[model samples]
Target: MPAPRKYPDELPERAVREVRTTSRPIAHVAKDLGIHKEALRGWVRQAEADAGERDDRLTAAEHEELKQLREEAAELRRANEILKAASAPFAQELDRPRTRPTRRSTA
Candidate 1:
């Protein structure tokens, strides 16, 4: 369900390494690779996360799990709402006793 990536993972890996090993600016590196500077910056951040250099972002698996959890939570909330709606009219009758209907005279 994920969108197609504009650039391949290998390309970013190579680009990040190029930026780190070379003294070139990130914009310069991204320009050389024909990628957007912001995209390249995201790749660098991701690389750092993968390397455990950054602690704020989640790892790929953790991020995936979180996405799945959020989706499941949304679905459960929807189901709860549906159940509530279906039982709305009946809920008020819980304490009432059943009664027989009065017969009507036929003409």
Candidate 2:
């Protein structure tokens, strides 16, 4: 599970908007908003990526899709392991020889 966010959702949006529109330094904006400069910078970068302004990072939608795909792949691997374990006994049974016992005649 993800850790809880330190700042509210609106704060990042407002900070990013300020950085974009006002052309002010990130540190200054962060100081004014009481946010960590690095966090605000990351938010700006992510917003740019989401807006198609940057290509170096995954957009929010792409990130979410990638996360979901990873979870699905993990689930498939777990299910495969379960099936392999369940079939082991049947595989061993198939490997054994089927021989009939001979009856002995009394003299």
Candidate 3:
């Protein structure tokens, strides 16, 4: 059986920076820090994901512009539908009204 594990009471703020500054393998870092290699890999993955999310958030103005454009398109479509409905009755009215034909006999 593997021996019981011991962990440091506190992790320094600069621990990651210090580890990255050196050219040592991650396994060496994990072993020297009394932690698991998989845990360090998990942290790296999470950090990359967070950076990607931050980059998306950085385009706040562009995102807002896109949202506004979508809303304007929806409004224009509704206006077009209302205009079509209003014009339909008038188009029918034009067809229904017709002058009666008149005929005059010539002498």
TM-scores for all candidates: the values are 0.74, 0.89, 0.39
> Roughly what TM-score does model 1 have, to 2 decimal places?
0.74
Candidate 3: misplaced stretches above 4 Å?
Answer: 1-58, 95-100, 104-107
- In lDDT terms, which candidate is top? 2
Residue-wise C-alpha lDDT for candidate 1, range 1-107, written one tens digit per residue:
77998888699889999988996999999998999999999888887887899999887778889999999999999999999999988987886888999999898
Weakest lDDT window of 10 consecutive positions for candidate 1: 89-98
| Candidate 1 segments exceeding 4 Å error | 1-4, 95-107
Candidate 3 positional error at 67, Å:
0.4
For candidate 2, the clash count comes to: 0
Query: Which lDDT tens digits does candidate 3 get at residues 1-107?
Result: 54653444244223444455785676777778767877665444444444564452435456579988999999999999999999999999988969888977797
Q: Worst lDDT window (10 residues) for model 3?
A: 5-14
Score candidate 3 by TM-score against the native.
0.39
Q: After superposition, how far is residue 81 of candidate 2 from its true place, in Å?
A: 0.7
Scanning candidate 2 in windows of ten residues, the lowest lDDT window is 5-14
lDDT of 1 at 26: 94
Q: By lDDT, is 2 or 3 better?
A: 2
Ranking the candidates on TM-score from highest down gives: 2, 1, 3
lDDT of 2 at 4: 95
